[model samples]
Target: MKKIIAFAGSNSSKSINYELVKYTVSLVDDFDIQLLNMANMPFPLFSEDDERKYGYKNSLVELKEDFDEADGVILSVNEHNGNPSAYFKNLIDWISRLERKFLEDKYVFLMGTSAGKRGALGAISVTENMLPRFGAKVENVFSLPEFNMNFSAKTNTITNSNMEKEHRKQLDDFLGKLIKK
Candidate 1:
């Protein structure tokens, strides 16, 4: 079976982006999905001085291996002050130090969500543009706005009909691309 890695970029234990990514992964069929929580894999704030002093951590090496082995990736980023969350950015920084092209040639399904109307658009857009430079073939992108109102935790469903339709369409397209590959 093809392997897909799904993760939310936030370190929040109750991250809405994490919930959104999990829900999206449930929509996919057949693929072996590995769900990762950034919160579970704790790392210190990344810094050049730290890298030079401590070298790479074992966890970072393992994370790069995960990216290398997976056939595809599903990443839903959380935004903070119009940027990717610090925790997520730190992971990226550490991962890049280990392997600059870690995501190279991997099919990436990028997504973001927020409790507000903008839906973490700034962060999502930044990732969409940047991933391609790292050689990731981003298959599709989706943003869920007003997440609390649209998504129901109890039902694990998008309550808003129009948003649900749009989400399904994007997911279907992503699945189609993965199937083709």
Candidate 2:
């Protein structure tokens, strides 16, 4: 079976992006999906000094192996100060140091969400722009805004009908690409 890697960039215990990823992966039926929670996998605040002092981490090598084995990735990033959260950025920094262009042409569905009206669009934008540099195709993108109002925690799904349609469409489109190859 084809494998899909799904993860939220946030490490918060109550991350809405994680909820979004759970709901998204539940919609898939054909592939073997692996859901990774960054919250449980702790990393040091990345710095040049740390890499120089400690060298590569075993966890990052394992992470790169997962990326290499997967056919696609579903990634939802959390926003902080109109950018991808520093925690997620730190993960990228450490992983990229392990190997350049580590994503290696995987099809990626980039997503984000927030309590505010902009849906964490800024973070989504930055991630989308940069993933290609890491060899991610970034095949689709979605942002859910006013997460509390648009998403239902009780039901674990999107509550707004219009947003639901677009959300499914994006998933379908990304799936189509994965299936075609």
Candidate 3:
């Protein structure tokens, strides 16, 4: 079976982005899905000085192994000030140092969500542009806006009919690309 890694780019214990990622992955079928929480793989704040001091940390190696093993990735990013959360950015910085092309040609289904109307579109756009530079084959991008209004935690469903239709279409497209040889 193909392996897919799903993660949220936030350290929040009650991350809405994490909830969004879980809901998105539930729409996929017939794959080995590994849900990784950034909070669980805590790393020191990345810096050139830290890199020089530590060389490479064991956490970076483990993260790389997971990325390398996965056939695809599903990522839901949390937006903070119209940018990726610090935790997510730090992970990217360290991972890039370890392997610049870690996501090389890996099918990536990118997503973001927020309580506001823009739906973390800024972060989503940035990731859509940046992931490809890291060799990610970004298949599709979706941003859920007004997340509190559109999604129901109780039912694990998108409440707005139109939004649900749009999300389903994007998910189907992403799944198609993921299974293609």
Candidate 4:
């Protein structure tokens, strides 16, 4: 079975991005999905001084291994004032140090979700521009705004039918791209 890693870009224990990612992962077929928590892969704030002081964080190694071994990745980022959450950005920074092109030629579905109107659009744009530079294929992208209003966590369903339909199309498109690669 093809293995995929799913994760959110937020450290909040109750992150809406995490909820959306889990929901998206559950809908995937014919893939072995592993959900990872940003909190579990903690890293020091990115800085030359920190790197010199504590060396590489263990979480970095674990994350690198997961990314290296996975055939694909599904990521849903949480926005903080129109940018990626600090924790997620820190993880990216550290990982880049270890492998400048960790996502090179990799299949990735970059997405984001939020309770606001923009639905983490800001973070999505930034990542879309940046991840490719790091060699991420970034096969597809989506944003779910007002996530709490559109998705029912307990039931694991998208409450709005139209949005769900559109998202399903995008997800199917992403899967097709991955399979073809």
Q: Which one is best on lDDT?
A: 2
- Model 2 scores what on Cα lDDT? 0.93
Name the 10 consecutive residues with the lowest summed lDDT in model 2.
96-105
The local lDDT score (0 to 100) that residue 157 gets in candidate 3 is 88
**lDDT score, candidate 1:** 0.89
Tens digit of per-residue lDDT, candidate 2, span 103-171: 887899989999999999999999999888889999799999999999999999999999999999999
What lDDT tens digits, residue by residue, belong to model 4 across residues 1-181?
7788899998888888888898899899898898997766666689988888888877787788888888888999889889998888888899988899888778888889899988899999988888887788886888888888988988988899988887888889888877877
Model 2, 149: alpha-carbon shift in Å?
0.3
Number of backbone collisions per candidate, in order?
0, 0, 0, 0
Backbone steric clashes in candidate 3, count: 0
Write down the lDDT that model 3 would get: 0.89
lDDT tens readout by residue for model 1, 1-181: 8889999999899999999988998888899999998888988889899989999889889889999889899999999999998888888888988888998888888999999999999999888888887779986888899999999999898889998998898888877777887
Residue-level lDDT tens digits of model 3 in 134-181? 899987888899999999999998899998888889888887887884
Measured against the true structure, the TM-scores of the candidates, in listed sequence, are 0.96, 0.97, 0.96, 0.95
lDDT of each prediction vs. the true structure?
0.89, 0.93, 0.89, 0.86
Could you tell me the C-alpha RMSD of candidate 4 in Å?
A: 1.2
